[model samples]
Target: MNEKEALILKLIKEDPFISHFDLAAKADLPGDRVAGYISSLMKQGKIVGRAYVLPEQRQVLCVGGANIDRKIWSKGVLELGTSNPAESSKSCGGVARNIAENLGRLGSGVSVLTAVGEDHEGHWLMEYTRAFADVAPSEILKGHSTGTYTAVLDQEGEMTVALAEMSLYDSITPEFIDRKWSYFASSDFIMLDTNFPADVLNRIIERCRKENIQLCITPVSSPKAKKLPHDLLGVTWLIANKDEAEAISGIKIETEGDFFRAAETIIHKGVEKVVISRGDKGLIYFTEKGEAGVLIPPAISIIDVTGAGDSLVAGIIYAHLNRIQTEDACKIGMACSILTLQSIETVNPILNNQQLLETFKQNFK
Candidate 1:
């Protein structure tokens, strides 16, 4: 990577979900000209995916929301009076962007098809995403004020109450996405988040089915996690946490057995497979043919729990695209998730096939 390319990469690592125009401004280049440089870097493998720039490789396309996550840290969980004895931070967030960044770090050709605002953070988010992966601006709809989530953290850095402003994406219509259907159709794998409107998701699901693309939909958080489109059966993989699993499938999960049952229910509902995460307890996966699970003991300490699921999805897709068996895929997903929980920000840790296999053997065996 040249100086400019290296600079761009640094900027991307600093902001994985930023836009192209902001990159041009930060890199001090004309907008159109900077876009050309980005394309060139992508062609040269400096940025190797369908994510930030135009499509040139068999990349993963993530369709979801991108947001600026603002967190406020206070004491006593806002119940026992305000005891300020902590820190606060702001970071790039959003399910699709998180997965895209993870895929890029894992050395996958990743791209994102999502929407952000025309405002400052939105521009920064777009530039960041482009720098990290292949984010096609054409697919990113403007005018909609970008979404944001504000969380109040307690002493332990655990979020208490989160106010998410996601209604801006309520207007993502099928007509808007019709323009970028080609990118969506050619992706090796398609990951969806419930952030988009139901109709838009329906259109994408229908299109992906027609194009023979594998779809993975994340219900995201527990509260208000939308159910998979009725036609989503057999066409999409269900990724959800224990809480989300219960909400979408109406299955009560009090133990590991319940988790497996929830996953099985989704699988029987038309999903080929389901991965349900029981944080700290590890993850359990159930596929159409059989059921298996893996437990990678927690890595010493947890710095931040954000983006861990996204990283796991990247690992799963990596295994899937590489034709690795389902069991092995779950292991890879677990390994990657552990690595992300240790890092302060999301990063793609490039591991060659041999390296990943070695890590798998040492960690799991």
Candidate 2:
């Protein structure tokens, strides 16, 4: 919080969509100097949070994977042998889709740019999404089967073995993304996932960067996400877990120092900021100059942890876009995660601003 850094933050907070040149002038510093200060401020949690906070009525474009998830649950630590779950159910499970749907529930206009098969499952998924959010069907490539994920949960409701299918998104090429980029031209933010091909993700990130579009990305799965192209850094706000971070950056993170070193390694690779969610341990956020950490207060009870991460991403981005500081955004994310882990679905139980505030109040009190 040097004076220049504080000024730089103020300028960006007032208008996150402003050009760097304009921000530089407003902060009365050299363009590159202002850029450095802004980046530093973000790492320090002064100008921390999303790049844009749109009017509550604006639209948010979510471009990524959509899948149906089937999970089997048992009473105790369910072993993999001879498997019949006590109960089984299906729900939407893709990271991008869950975040988009939850954002819609939070009263933001949401549109999903993804591909789904023309099959029965895709048909049902389309119908379901249309009921809750505005879906850009043109973004969907119809031919391949809809993606799906299956998980086996123990009595503790923790996932054991899980399988993901996302080959359907292979059809989302640059041509497809270019055509649909305009749909997001009027959007407040554009969120994506690693389900897309590296070239396609790079193109999308380039477009967002060239247009000063706020871009967020959630690495869908650790093993599958190991292929993310390093060049797509700097253009996206990366959201991942501890394992995913290790997988993507090729570094192990067991302590805060390790997390710091790992984050620096990735940032030097071109990433602007890294947000890592460490399950029950909480979250760690890092940028070029600094980092912040938080712990998830113990949950009352765990029902299902399936959509918790998605909910957290949505909550943080939503809070940031609404003018909350980055640290507060993490708290908001933690709250959303807590609610989702206590519920069966991936979405938050609360609706509307009043309900959200109330939930925060009751929980903290």
Candidate 3:
């Protein structure tokens, strides 16, 4: 790496999602010349193409569900058990998939693993996701249908009920994880969602323990949250919503004190850190470093709440990679959640590192 290449690489290291134009401005070079340096970096294997994985920054594998999400929002007050006029939208979604996409959007080296059917939907899911996270480790199951989730929301965009057809996820077994062991072995961090079964989760958690890799686990919902083992000895972070938190901790959370108790319970379960999201009430977090607090998001109009939590996880991971403080990392996460709440899409198309930092500074400071 010569002087110019060294300079560009330094800028890239600082800003994972740095644009070519921004790089040119920072490097004091011609805009068109930035591409050549990027190309050279790619050729020299100093950085991975598109995702820009540098040797110093290890990759993360997000293991869990990947599927089609169909959302239906009622145009007016929803009536129970009756047909109501609604507007519907469809998009690529799933817990791990959304988190991986958000991480990719924020310029992290991330790969998503899941089971998709050998059908057009499966093909399109993999191809569309490739634009964000690496989907090469995902498998396509023959003679099986891809999983799906359908959510019904009220006019306020709050999900009233949801139905999930996620049987395909059963195919993502321990053997499947073994097949992708190389990815896990090379990763410095690994993220898992409860969409995987108990054995699969336990296997990966144990391997992460053996490898001494950092692990973050997100439970998909209240029911699936039970999939986690009683011994969470190797888990680094357990991020969950209030209901899911209640399920995991066996605590009925009706007040602020209950929330803290729940987090403490999970921490005692051997998770290094615990964060329980309280929706509009803000979030409560207890970190491994002994930083604890509640962060309430600044008021903003919410267009949709689909990917807000996933974006929060992405923001924390981004902050950790950048060496941000733990409390502020949660603040960045709160900022990311607020940004995602303003978007109708699952993952906000306009999200980047700069936007997230700006939002953090504006709202949190």
Best candidate (score: TM-score) = 3
Give residue 234's error in model 2 in angstroms.
3.7
TM-score of each: 0.78, 0.79, 0.84
Candidate 2 overall lDDT versus native: 0.73
lDDT of 3 by residue, 163-201 (tens): 999997776778878656756765778889999888999
lDDT of 2 by residue, 89-206 (tens): 8876677778877787777778787788888778777778775577753344556888998887877888887888878777777887765554656567888878888888888777
Clashing pairs in 2: 53-321, 75-155
Q: State the displacement of the C-alpha of residue 18, model 3, in Å, after optimal TM-score superposition.
A: 37
- Identify the runs in model 2 with alpha carbons over 4 angstroms from their true place: 1-58, 137-140, 289-291, 349-351
| Cα-based lDDT at residue 357, candidate 3 | 81
Candidate 1 regions exceeding 4 Å error are: 1-55, 74-83, 137-143, 294-296, 346-362
Superior candidate under TM-score, 1 versus 2? 2
Ranking by TM-score: 3, 2, 1
RMSD (Cα, Å) of model 3: 10.5
lDDT of all predictions, in order shown? Answer: 0.73, 0.73, 0.86
